[model samples]
Target: MQSSFSPLVAISPIDGRYQKQVNELSGYFSEFGLIRYRVRVEIEYFILLAEKGIFKMPAKIKPAQLRAIYEEMSEADAQQIKETEKTTNHDVKAVEYFIKDQLHQLGGDEVAEWVHFGLTSQDVNNTAIPLLWKEAVEESFMPYLLNLIATVKEMARTWKKIPMLAKTHGQPASPTTLGKEIMVFVERLQNQIDLFGYVPYAAKFGGATGNFNAHQVTFPKHDWVAFGNEFVNERLGLQRMQFTTQIEHYDNLAAHFDTLKRINTILIDFCRDIWTYVSMEYFKQKTKKGEVGSSAMPHKVNPIDFENAEGNLGVANALYEHLSAKLPISRLQRDLTDSTVLRNIGVPMAHSFIALKSIEKGLGKLLLNETKINADLENNWAVVAEAIQTILRRVKFPQPYEALKDLTRGQEGITQKSLHKFIDGLDVADKIKNELKAISPQNYTGVEFDY
Candidate 1:
């Protein structure tokens, strides 16, 4: 808190070179952020207890005063909590004690003991983590993702009619529109992003061991399970995991991670394809004055942005995979592994944010080389063999596939003249020959898509 952080001295690139791009994530994923969320949960739980008549709130204790404890918590307050943690050696306990002190100062000392009543550290943690994660996704992550999707959508529509050769197994198989190729990723990404809505922002809120043992034993007439469900669902806007151990099952959280990993994987594929296009001169990147594309080669303009995006996306996916796999497992009732692992949730999110920004920038700099694309299609006249054979079959021609293969397969420089000659010599009528002659790589692309 007294200032030791500097970009030059930071260890991870997320906090160093790329910090400016993803700094907003600190509000939800930083150490101070974690403490603030914990304080929010503790204070909210206390207010809910008073509202339930679990304890009596004095007239002087206004709801605003209670909320202000967390809403207005400053760096100094978080630093104070860190100092307390240094002595207590328990982070959540530090937050609890900090709230108790706030309550005492507000002349509500009588109910200060109820600040974290009948709760274990996990009750505060499990709730706070999901609440912060939900906010981060909704407020921070989704906007960029939606904007990226929109940008891609607009690009797709812009290139909707542009035809390019389609490659399968690194060889030209047929022709597809550039827009449809881009839309493939767009559809895949949207499909996965939509799944986030179904994966609930889930939290575990029952007392220690998830039984609410202490709450029920103290108030035998009250249904503590119902209270937990309401507190987590109604109050926090998160789904409560009805059954869990000392920690939340994290199945929903893992689902979210898996979905995110898939989105990143799609983006990686997109980046690679775009990079290939740039290499093939299908895309010409815009150059800025005084910007060096390569130190050794002055004539080169590299696709560094797409390369950056691919690298960061790969890193993010690795972390997401680990998080999805590791978070759902713990030693019996609980383990400290998740505690440490969960703290790093923002690391992958930051990497992903950086990669998304890079991809957006890369896309902005792309200058579509329609000439190159059309030239590629024109050069690959052999690709139209598929269309010719398919049309011949429609006319009930004899062995149409084999005939077309003989003319195209293992043959170079199969120009339109040669194809026309082949069609003219066929045993079909002039109408059929004219129809076969009409087929060309440029016009042989499959049906147009409405999306």
Candidate 2:
């Protein structure tokens, strides 16, 4: 039976309203995707066994033919496995049966018994889940994030010379370049992205209970430990966990979730900052034809993209927190909890992917309002007090901070004339007074960065 599930009827927004943005993720995290990965693991393990001479394969059976079982896996194949699961009441076992049925069709029934030999469900699951996750991160997630960072960097470079008032505790405090402010997020995101390398894409391939008891009892002479390592590390390109329970220990997996959560948190911060900038009119959005930002308000152009990104990032962070906290703690050796939780690994990923796309779109639409930015600088002359006071301090002037504070603090209508008047009254050299007059909010920004 074909899936009648359409986006219109889907429950989650990731699958419904935002499905188009995240459709590519289904290939990595969907039920069919999971089943396909299981098939791949089973076939590869069987081929490894054959290469090790653990079983005599028919001379006619080619490795390519075995590999095609998974490479050519279709929705029909996944559905057949699901049907088998109904009878077996076990998902991994259904995959094994499906592979055996394929081998039977290929005139290699003799080797079919060796498929998934001496392995429990965790052996396939622990390896497959992490392997697929590794692929998804490298292939999809990292690319999107890198692209977003590049966009941010480009914007930063463009506005590197643009001065804007800085706010601390929601009040104008100092002056900073727009580029430097944007670059802050770039450095923060890159720092966390680099940490991904430290947390390994770890997997467990040991047989039931973290030891190869079945393999050892059947063939005590074979080095099953080395076999497990080579299969998981070399063949699958995943870091093999040497010691584990029936399930993977999941500490490394938790680390991955935490790292992802931190990344999302940074994105959330970026979204809010961008939204605030939009509200401040430092940035204007390019209005689309026939698109309404607000139904009732005609002149409004809302920062919906950043708003969407923030909301999605919030949802993604919540899921990441649960996944990170829950996956590491299980009942003694193993339990069913990680199995269900592991399946949801893709849920937060899909949300994060959507948020990334939203952020990219939001960034692309930003039109820097240089007039507004400059006007803001011009209006907030009080910010220059810091520069004047700091220079006064450098000159060993008495009560520099107090003097500047008295002139600017809570005093309304402080303008160029008023500040210049105060500067002329200072008991300092003409050069010092001239220096103070030159320091406006626009030029009060600190040293230029190489951004």
Candidate 3:
């Protein structure tokens, strides 16, 4: 049955099922956003031309008038550009026409012909996309990622001394503090985010085939290359790729995607570890009123938030991998492949945002079960064999590790009493024996938990 809703719908889930979680990103990713960016590039280019006196624009265009034109670019103006695009069937040409129309209203029609002078569609698109990406990262992605890191840091500080039994290959091995485990992720994410910052948001402004052919033919005396560099790097605040095909190489963008993927992988690792901790009863979830963890299972309070984060991180990493791999490998000088792919740059980012929110939610729900942590550590007294053996080594005891291994290895349910009894029978001095008794699993978490 057809509902009352419109038949038109987005093919991607970013605009469909998960739309609400990512709707705020549309202002930087939608068709309207694309149009707005294009207009901005055209407007900036025109302003730069005037500032450089490349074209003898009308003297009536005062500084205030230029500011007004730039500031007055509203949603309505973006819509007008879209309307123009529909008629022209060429996105960049439509922008040129739109700017020319606006210039007519501003009584600057005498210089309208030079609006898109000596450039191709790639010039506008490359600059606009980088601008959008830069703004989105600074405004949306970075804040959330930094917040996540901060949340992890807080958890690290809070759980700094909470000793828990450590497992290796699913077997009790040693003891570690919960805070140190959380700090591992914090350190990993910080490193990857640092790498992400190093990746430049690069753009290409050379004409059709990177030669600036038309630009040189029109004014051979002018250094169009130098002007392109200044316009892109200085005015637009993007790294200008001096040499490229019709489209940018996208190597830097690929590096950005790879960096994001690494961070997501780290978060995925964190979610899995937290989920396992919850399952092991080391962490209990705060129950929400009216929230059903399961439909039929009354006693089930699932780790839904962490599960959600893991799923979204997986989705985001998949997209990031594809973007990083595909964006840098165009067919030749240019192809339409990157154009369509570029439009969905925000999809992976939206998933990343969604995952961040989920992780934050999961972190909020976590209630550390100190009793469980202590009980687990207390029960795993066999873990202290490492400490006892190491201390014995310090005192030059004969075959200290072998002695501890014989006493603890394959011995099920080795309690504190059993370990202490074995320590008392040792031929070590009273001081060494006392030290061994003090090395319980609860206090044996070496420097792993020290913040």
Candidate 4:
């Protein structure tokens, strides 16, 4: 097919530079996605009403015929909705018309009036958007996040015992196993992922202004709240909010966005740490054939992957922050601000996906420099002072901390030989000297790799 780009190209990079990486999400967030979701909602609502006996459906909607209504909804069907939208200039109205046409084709013109029943554009939009978000999280976001976590966990296990010099304030402070450092991120991500799982995908389903005014006035006999709950929770797999205005209050959606921002923040932290490690020569990147790290510096194997991950994560978090903050506060009953803002939800998520991919790639390129790690530990002998002072305290030595502080603190080139020599000069017994002699920076990474 000959493709014609939209007359006005997208101003956002989600539809520009990084579109390919996040194309999979187009099925959940694009114009077509919106149409598909609307159709699903209309179909399901029809089915729900039939099951509830609110309207007498045909004697039998054969399984094949039922499937035909759902299965026949394709890209073409969505395009038809778009076509209708151009004339109506109202997106939800287009969907209602399209579904009514479909209902007419099925010889159910008598029931066509019940397609949207008594609902507002927000009702379809709120439920449909949440449904799409749910599917996107389940199929794309969660799997990718879980895979990233799994990879980090594997790295943690593989490098658990590999001791490296620990840095605080960008200076060597102590020793820590490489595995333990990785596990720190693993644990953090796992905790956030658990929270992400628990956050409910909520939707608003009452009529305009959230009071079910129209539905209640028309069908005063029916329990509309119960019906709304059942339709949203059971049929749509979303938690229904009983009270709302012209649109969903978006409190839960805001919470969901904030949660995503937290995850993105944690990833940004991890990317920076790994980038620093790479810069410190603790980790080396695997060179790919024909890939250039720098234009002029031929010898440069830059930490670009982590840099990219960090940059994209920053963008994602900024957008997430805006979405979380802006979506929840609509003027009085409602406003169009959220309508425009909500459309960009996928942009931040797409950037996040891009960042995730970059991190995954960066992780795959890592070649742990065991030699550099060991050399760093050997050179930073001053780190052993903690173990030495603690051991001295174990033997009830007077001013043990002060003694070690005087011996090692502010003393550069304080090697193993120097420490041992100092230990030997102590007034403490041979057993104490022997015990202190065994303490080394290499082994001072206390209990980090016991797992």
Candidate 5:
């Protein structure tokens, strides 16, 4: 420990530069947090044993004394466990010892023997980690995602009717409402987020090889499998895998990371699109009084927030990819690879948290350049060719597509007059010709949606 902690010396930005912004994650992901959760699982398991009648409580011991083991955990309690870990060289064993010591202190030495009875370290690690992850997602990630979605939704509503030039293959095509374009991303995000809801936050609770071999061996009459399912599902609020090795299969956890990867991919796409819009003058950022975009280029009001978002999201997705690929595969019963990898799970999450903040900040700074958006639409009158060609099709006009293709395609700066002149030559009835003549790039966006 330093005399004064500082971000300057921290290795990862998650614990350093961005610490303040992501401090809320500490209660679920930090070292002390891990120890705290481990203690919770141990205490709960001890209590569960009694409730299930697998362990009879000592006469002098009260249930409240057991509950206080975790409810009253503190920095000193976690530090004591850390001190015990040095001697045991096993994290879960250290927690077991700490809980046993606590039970002794409560004058329940008779009941202390049941602290971690018939369980391996994975029993604690798998349950504690998933429980921690569950809370982190529910408490931290989902809110950020929902808030971002809502903010974008509000932007869509505010700009619903504002027409902008659409691009296909980097060339002007038909026009689209800015809101509709924004909604494209909103729909993509919501679709994935909806699917994310179905991917279970699963855990493995079987003793050593996912079969409750030790549990069944010790208590031949007890339905250990049923007990595990009920405890993991009802008590811990997580899905219990029916079969496993020494570790969880991690298939569901991988799916969760994959879902997060999809989300980050969508967000990266958004950041880049927004950045491009800023470069194209379709957006102006609200600049602060003394903030600098460039060291030398003084006039620039850069889209740094979006850029920040893109970078962090890319980093997050990279880590998430690794997690998805590596966590699900292990040798035979189990290996140590998943052990070290699981510990760093919070790193990717931290990156994602950072990315969401950047995106929110970027979105807040956006000021739509209506004049530029309209000018883009006005200048690309050739975009109306789609509407004209479609209307021409309705009138049974031959060669309408070729006619417009010849008149506008590859012709730089085709104006409204040029389109109207082409409409005048059409063999359609007067009413239909007039309809075609009235269309312009600014008014050519197809059927508006309520969103």
Candidate 6:
């Protein structure tokens, strides 16, 4: 909490160069933020114990005042908790002490000892961390993702009718509508996003080693398992993992990270394709009045946004992949490895947040080059060989693929005249030959597709 760093001095770019792009995540993942959420869980759990008839409310206490604990917490309060942690050398216990101190101030020192009774540090941590993650994803991250998806959908609709030459294995293959090609990413992304909704945002609520040992032993007959399920599910708004070690198994959390990795990978693919199109002159970037594209060149408008997005996305995916692989594997009852790693969960999310904004910015700056798209369609006349050969196959023409292969394969210049001349020389019926001649690279795009 000491003030020794600014953006200029920060080591990680997420907290420095791109801080503004990713600051929204600080409310959920920063140390102050984590402490705030931890206190919230502690307060809520104390209230739950009261509601369960485990204790009588202290006569001097006001329930309304108690519920306002998290809302009323300030930077001073978070700083105090950090100071307390320095002495305790334990974070959650420090939070517990902070709550007890607050209770004493509120004239309820009689019940102050109940603050974190019958709970392990993990109960507070796992619940609080998942709650923070759930809120961050739902409120902050999804909006950016939806904007990118919506931008893609809008581009698909706008470019749907624009014909362009399609490439396969770096060669002109068939003709496709520009919109259809863009929609391929939209559909693939949507499928993965849909799957993301079902990966349970789960938490481990049983005490140390995940068996509710303290609660069961203290109450003797308190239905602690049912209490844990209801408290985690209804009160905390997170799924309670039914079993675990001293920590949550983190399987669900790993699932969440893997899903994010997949989504980032898809966006990486998108960035590369758009970069290629920009390089090919099929798209141009709008420029700011005074922005420089190069240090020495005067006439270059680089696709830096897409490049930034690709780079940031790669970094995000690497973290996500590591989190998915490492978080779920633990040493027997549990190890301290996960504790440090868990604290860094926000690193990947922040990088991804920056990348999404970059992608959105890149999409907004695009100026579709229709002339170049049309020119490619016009120049690549041999791309229509697929349509002609397929029609010949439909009409039972002998060795239609072979025939079209002979005419178009590796040919330097196959124009409308050359294809029509070949059609004229074919032994097929005049009507069939005429149909083949009508198929042009400009008009041979497949059936209309939209999503």
* Local distance difference test values of all predictions, in order: 0.92, 0.91, 0.86, 0.86, 0.88, 0.89
Worst-scoring 10-residue span by lDDT in model 2: 1-10
Off by over 4 Å in 4: 1-11, 60-72, 448-451
Comparing 2 with 4 on TM-score, the higher-scoring candidate is 2
* Steric overlap count per candidate: 0, 0, 0, 0, 0, 0
lDDT of 4 by residue, 1-451 (tens): 1125552476877777776788898888887777788778878887888788888887645435644655566777778888999999999999889878876777778888988888899999999999999899899988999999999999999998888899998888779889999899888888888888787999999988898898899889999999999999998999998778989878888888888898999999999999889988999989989999899989989988889989999998999999999999989999899998988888888999999998999999999999998998999898988888888888888998999899877778899888888888888999889988887788888775554
> Which lDDT tens digits does candidate 2 get at residues 1-451?
2366898988998889998898888888999988988888888899899889899999898999999988988888999999999999999999999999988888998888899999999999998999899999999999989988998999899999999989999988799999999999999999999998788999988899989999999999999999999899988999899889898888998999999999999999999999999999999999999999899999999999999989999999999999999998989888798888899999999999999999999988999999998887778888889888899998899999999889999887888888899899999999999989988888888889896
Model 3: ten consecutive residues of lowest lDDT? 1-10
Winner of 3 and 5 under lDDT = 5
Model 1 Cα lDDT, one tens digit per residue, 1-451: 2346898889999999998999899989999999999999988888888899999899999989989988988999999999999999999999988988888898877888897899999999999999999999999998899899999999999999998988899887799999999999999988998887889999999999999999989999998988999899998999999889999999999999999998999999999999999998999999999999889999999999889999998999899999999999999999999999999999999999999999999999999999999988888888988888888888888999999898899899988888888888888789888888888888888898998
Q: How high a TM-score does candidate 3 get?
A: 0.95
RMSD of each: 1.2, 1.3, 2.8, 2.0, 1.6, 1.5
Give the TM-score (vs. native) of candidate 2. Answer: 0.98
TM-score of each: 0.98, 0.98, 0.95, 0.96, 0.97, 0.97
Off by over 4 Å in 3: 1-11, 63-71, 448-451
Q: Which residue segments of model 1 deviate by more than 4 Å?
A: 1-4
Candidate 1 global TM-score = 0.98
Give the runs in model 6 whose Cα sits over 4 Å from its true position: 1-5
Compared with the true structure, what per-residue lDDT tens digits does model 5 show for residues 1-451?
A: 1124687899999889998878888888888788888888888888899989997887777777777877777888888988998999999999999988888887777878798888889988999999999999999989888989999999999999999998888888789999999999999999998998998889989887888877888899999989899888988999999888989989999999999999999999989889999999999999999899899999999998888888988998999999999999999999989998998888888888998998999899999999999988888988888788887888888978998899888898688777777778878899998888778777888899998
Poorest lDDT segment (10 consecutive residues) of candidate 4: 1-10
Shift in Å, residue 83, candidate 6: 0.4
- Candidate 4 vs candidate 6, lDDT winner: 6
